[model samples]
Target chain A: MIHLLAFGMIADVLEHPEKDWPWSADTAMLRAALIKAYPELRDLPFVIAVNMDVAGGEQPIPPGATVALLPPYSGG
Target chain B: MKNIFIQGSIAASFIGESIAKHQSKTDIGAHAIFLGQVRADVIDGQPVSRIDYTAYEDMALQKVHEIREAAFDKYPLTCMHIYHSLGSVGVGEISFFVFVSSAHRAAAFDALREIVDAIKADVPIWGKEIFAEGQGSWKVNQ
Candidate 1:
């Protein structure tokens, strides 16, 4: 299983801090699955962090990786 | 990892104490401080009462560590401290504090500006501006 975390507005949309998903080799497929499950995520400005680092959609989703959806930062 | 995250608002007493703690370091000739307070911005017809802050803790810590290291490399500084609130902070309450000390005023001023700018642009912290009536909107840095 792959663990996915959400923060900021994305967490509000997901309604939880983290969620589990069946492992998928393709990063694009995983993103698609997520958007399908949470339609509201499609419109939000965010980035995907794989293993605590920002990752591109083309990058492979490593097995059992910790993923996070991070919204644009507003820190001062 | 260094403890930079504080819950709720950063108090004036805490800021005063931080300054007092540095008094023993007489080598430092100048100190610079930057404090970020939550503004009561009016949106539409409602006014913001507070801000709810959140962050990806591990990543934020790592990023802040890198930023600190970079700042040290680029500036001549005696010490630096960065503190950010993680929970709710009401309007006019302090949400972020950055302190920099150096032997010269120039270094302290330059380092403080650079550090504060880096934190705002690079840190993965988020803020939700909550209105008086319980409604809120995610804050976006301009």
Candidate 2:
């Protein structure tokens, strides 16, 4: 299982800020699965981060890795 | 990681204290400070009276660490401090503060703006605009 975290609108879309999912794959696959699970995610803009680092492309997600879905930053 | 998240609005006294603490470091010739106030915004006739902030703490601190490192790498900064509100901040209250000091005015000024901009663009923090009567919407940084 891998730990999944979400923030902002993405958390609202997922209905939870963090959770554990029984899935282990690269960042791209996780994005697809998430969009498939929650169609609302498809309409939202966000980026995937693995282990606190923003994934540049189809970055691999090692087992037990922590993944985060971060929406556009609104900080100042 | 260094905790930059403050529970509420940043007080003027706190800012004064921060400056006072730096006076001992006489080598610093310039200090640039940036404050982000929660503006009372009107959206669809609903006025935003406060902003509720949130973040992924670990990730945010990590990203901030990176930003801090990059600034130091690129600038001859003597000191840099960043603080952001994490809870409800009322309109006209200070929610974000970036303090940068250097041996010269030019580097301090440039680093302060870049650091503030980087936080807005790269950090994971979010602000929910709470209007009067508690009606709210997500804030979009322009």
- Per-residue C-alpha lDDT of model 2 across residues B44-109, encoded as one tens digit per residue: 999999999999899899999999999999999999999999999999999999999999999999
Off by over 4 Å in 2: none
lDDT (C-alpha) at residue B32 in model 2: 98
Name the top DockQ candidate.
1
In model 2, residue pairs whose N, Cα or C atoms come closer than 3 Å (at least 3 residues apart or on different chains), thus clashing, are none
DockQ for every prediction shown: 0.87, 0.86
Q: Over the stretch B33-119, how does candidate 1's per-residue lDDT look in tens digits?
A: 999999999988899999999999999999899999999999999999999999899999999999999999999999999999999
Report each candidate's C-alpha RMSD, comma-separated, in the order given.
Answer: 1.3, 1.2
How good is model 2 by TM-score? Answer: 0.96
